[model samples]
Target: MTPDSPASIRPAELAGLDLLASAVVLVDSGGHIVYVNAAAENLLESSLKALARQQLAALFAMPQELEHIVAQAREHKFSDVRQELALERAGREALHVHIIASAMDRPDGAVLIELREIVQQMKQDREERLLDQSQVNKELIRNLAHEIKNPLGGIRGAAQLLEMELPPLHLTQLREYTQVIIKEADRLQTLVDRLLAPHRRPHIVGDVNIHEVLERVRSLILAEFPLGLTIRRDYDASLPEFRGDKEQLIQAVLNIAHNAAHALAARIEQGDAEIVFRTRVARQMTLAKVRYQLALDLHIIDNGPGIPSQIRDRIFYPLVSGRDGGSGLGLTLAQTFVQQHMGVIECESRPGLTDFRILLPLP
Candidate 1:
C-alpha cells in the first residue's frame, strides 16, 4: 500500500472523524491526501476519488502559505493552534477558515488539517449587533415619544385659548393663524402616535400567507399611484403558510412598497417605473443566534434612482428620511414589525436597483 494514499487507512482510523461538522483532511509527510471526510469532500467540491490523489497546492490557490504552516507543525515541538486565514477555492473566491495543523502520533508522518469557515461566525456576530441596536432604538423612540406627547397637548390647547381670547370679529383674518397651529398640532400628534404604534400595539397572530400580504400591498400601492407605477410579482407558490399577524405584515410591506412608489415619481411620469416582489427559500440559515434549517426570503426591488447613500444606513431609524417632506417613520415601523416576527430587514442600493430583503425563519 502506498504510504501517501489514505484509502488504505483502516476503517477504525476513520472512527468519530466522519461525524465532525467541519471539514477534516489527513495528508502524508509529502502533503498527499490519504483521507478526506464527507465534509471535506463538500468543502473541496470534489469526489472522494479525485480528492484522494490531490496535493495541498492543487486544492488551495495559496499552497505556499499552508505549506509553511504544515512545516511548522512538523518541525516545532508544540503543534500550531487553529488560526484564521484565507484559502483560495478552485482558483476562485477566497474562503476564510480557521485552520489547525497537527502532526499525527504515528510514524507515517501524516498531518491532520481541521478547517471551519469564519464567515459563519461573522454572520452570527452581525445579527447579534443588529438585534442589540434594534432594542436600543426602540427604547430611545419610546422615551422620545413620551417627551413629545406631554408638550403637544399643552401647545394645542394654548393655541386654542389664545385664539378664543382674540378680538372676535376684528381678528377673523388672524383666525387662520390659530387654525394653522391646531392643524399642525393634530398632524404632529398623529405622527407621534404612529411612532409609538409598533410598541403599544399587540401582535395578533394567525395563519399568514406572504403572497397574500404582498398582493394586498401591491393593490394598495397601485390604487394610490394608479397612473405611473407598475408592480410585478415573482412568487414561489410552493411556500407554506406560517403563523403571523396578516394585517401587520401587510402594513410592513406596504410601507416599503409605498416609499418605493413615491420615489419613482420621475420614472412614473416617464411611465417606466417598476417594483418587483420576489420570494424564495433559503436553506440552513442563521438569524439572531438561532440556526434555522430553512428561511423565507422576500425581496422588494425598485428601479427608482435608489436610496441616497447618506441616509441608506439610517433609513430604518425613526425620523430619518431621504426625501423632502418625508415623515421617515415608514421604514422604522416596518422594521419593528418584522423584528417582532424574529426576522430581519436588510437593504442593498445603488444607482438603478434598490433591493430590500426580509429574512424570516421557517418552522
Candidate 2:
C-alpha cells in the first residue's frame, strides 16, 4: 500500500496490521508521534492515543547515535535497516533495539520507524567475531607451540649440559645464567600450554545444567577465600538443558567467579562481599547468525570495588589483568570457552557492582 493513502485505510485495518507485526511508529518531521501502531504501543507500554502528538524524545532517553539516525532520516530522507540502538522502556529497563526507519511518502512529511529487540543481533555479531578469532588463535597457538616451544626445549637442555662443563668459580655464574634461561623457557612453555589447551582437548558435549557449574564454582571460591563472603544463586528452573562441553563450561564459569572473588577481597574481609549467580532463559535468541527460541542467560555479579576503568576495556584480552597477582588468563580463557559453545560474554561495571553476562544457545 502507498504511504500517502493513510486517509483511505480503515482504522481497524491499520491497527490490526500494527498488532500483527513487531513495533511500528510514524513520526512527523517535528519529532511528534503522529501515529503509533499497536505493536509500538505494547513495546513502549503506552497507548497509541496517549502517544499521539507527544514528542518522541519525551518517551525515552534517546542515545546520541539514535538521535543521529533520526536526524539523518529527516535531513536526507535516509532509510536504515538493522541499525542497532539502545532505548529505555517505560518500565526503565534498558533495551537494545534495532531501528529501521524510512521516509514516508506523504505530503505531511512523516517517517515510518520499526523497532526490534537487538540483544539477539548483538549476540550473533559477537559470536561470529569470536568464532572467527578463535580459528586464527588456534592456528597461531599451534604454530608457536610447535616452532618456538620445540626450540626453547632444546635450548634449555643445552644450557643444562653447558652448565655441567664449567670451572668451579665460573660454574656458579654459568649455572645462574643457565637457570635464568631455563626458568624463562619454562614460563613460556606454560603460556603455550594455556594457549593450546582448548584446541588440544576434545569437547565432550553433554546436557549441562548451568546451576551445577555455578555451584561448583561457588564451593571452590568459598573454600579458597573462607572469610566473610556470601554467594547466592538465582536460577530459573524452567530453563532447558543446553548441549555443551561440561568440563569447559565449568572452567569458564569458574574463571569468572574467581575474578569476582578476587575483586571482592576487601568487601569479603569487611563481611559485605556478595557474589550472585543468576540464570534466566532468553527467548528469540540469535547466535552466530542463527535464531533460536531459547538461550541461556548466566550472570555473575559482584559487589566490590568495581573493575578499574583503565583495564576494563581490555579485560578479555590475553595478559590483561586488574589485580596484582592475577595471571590475566581467566577472562580470556572464559571468553574462549564460551565462544566455543556459540555463546557471547559481556561485562558491565561501576564502582559498586560488576556483572558478567554469558549468553549461550540452548538445545
Candidate 3:
C-alpha cells in the first residue's frame, strides 16, 4: 500500500471518527498512548501531542477495575467493558469518569478506550431524582389543600360571628385581629390555587415566541421599577417558536425576573441596577432525563447584590426567601409550572451577579 493510502495510514485516523463527547485514547500492547483525541485532551487536561509517547498508567493512575478491563482487552482479540476511574486534571480536583474499553485490530496491537465524565452522569441522575421528588411534593400539596380548605372556611366564619358579638369599642380591635387571620388564610388559599392551577386547567400548548415573554416581563419590570434600573434584551432572532404552555411559561419567566428585580433594589437605589433577559437555542439538552435536539434557553441575569449566601442552596424550596416581605412561593411555583412542561430551572449566584437559566424542550 502507498504511504497516503487509508490502509497504510497511521493509527491516528481513529481521531477522525464521529465519536460521542467522550475521551478516546489509543494505547499499544505495552500501554503506551499512541494517540489521543481532542475530547481526551479536555478530559485529561493535557495536550495530545504532549501525551503521545507517555505510558497510560503514568498519565491516568487508572482504578483497579479499569486496569483489569484493559488487561483483559489486551489478552482477548477484542473486549468491551465499562468501569469507573478517578483522574486528576490539571488545575482541577480529581474527577470520576466512566471508561469503556475495546481492543482494536490495528497492526500496532492498540486498544481504544472511551471515557465520559461521571459528574455529567451524576447530574442527570440528580435531576431525575429531583423531578420525582417534586412530583411527590405536588401530590402532597394537592391532598393537603383539600384537607385544609374546608376547616379554614369554618374558622374564618367563626371569627366573624365572634366579632359580631363583641362590644362596639372592643369589636373594632377584635375585627382587626380577625381580619389579619382571615387575610392570611385567604393568602394561603391563593397559593394553593396557584399550585393547583396547572393540573386543573388544560395545557394551552401553542407556538410560543420566547421573545414575547421576555418583552412582556421587561415592560412590567420597567413599569414597576422604572427608576435607577435598566432592562436589556439579548434575543436570538433565528430562534423558532416552541410548543409550550404559554401562560404557565409566562408565569415561570416572570417569577424569575421579578426575583431578580427585588434583589437589585439596592443596586437600583445606586443607579447601577441591570437586569438582562437573554434567549438562545441550546443544540442538545437533556431535560427530565430525556435528551432533545434543540431547547429554548432563557436567562434572567441581574447585577445586584446577588442571592444571600444563607438561602442560596435552598432557593428553590417552598417558602424559602431572602428578601423581606417576599412570598417565597414565586420560584417554587415557577419551578412547578416549568416542570409540568418537561423543563428544568437552574440558578447560579455570586456577589454582584445572579443568573437563573431555564431550559425548555422545543417542539
Task: Give the poorly placed runs of model 1, Cα more than 4 Å off.
Answer: 1-57, 70-86, 89-125, 164-174
What does the lDDT come to for candidate 1? 0.84
Could you say which candidate leads in lDDT?
1
Worst 10 residues of 1 by lDDT: 75-84
On a 0 to 100 scale, what is the lDDT of residue 320 in model 1?
93
Model 3: residues >4 Å from true position, as ranges? 1-71, 76-97, 102-112, 163-174
lDDT of each: 0.84, 0.78, 0.79
Instruction: Please give, for residues 46-130, the per-residue lDDT of candidate 2 as tens digits.
Output: 8977877777765556556655667777665545533766677655667777787777655656777788767644545666776
**Which parts of model 2 have CA positions greater than 4 angstroms off?**
1-42, 46-113, 116-147, 167-177
Backbone clashes in model 1? 1
Q: Order the numbered candidates by TM-score, best leading.
A: 1, 3, 2
Tell me each candidate's RMSD, in Å, in order: 4.2, 6.5, 5.6
lDDT of 1 by residue, 228-332 (tens): 788999999988899888888899999999889988999999999999999999765666666566788999999999998888878888889888888989999
Error of 1 at 245 (Å): 1.3
Clashes by residue pair, model 2: none
> Number of the top candidate by TM-score?
1
Q: How close to the true structure is residue 334 of candidate 2, measured as C-alpha lDDT?
A: 91
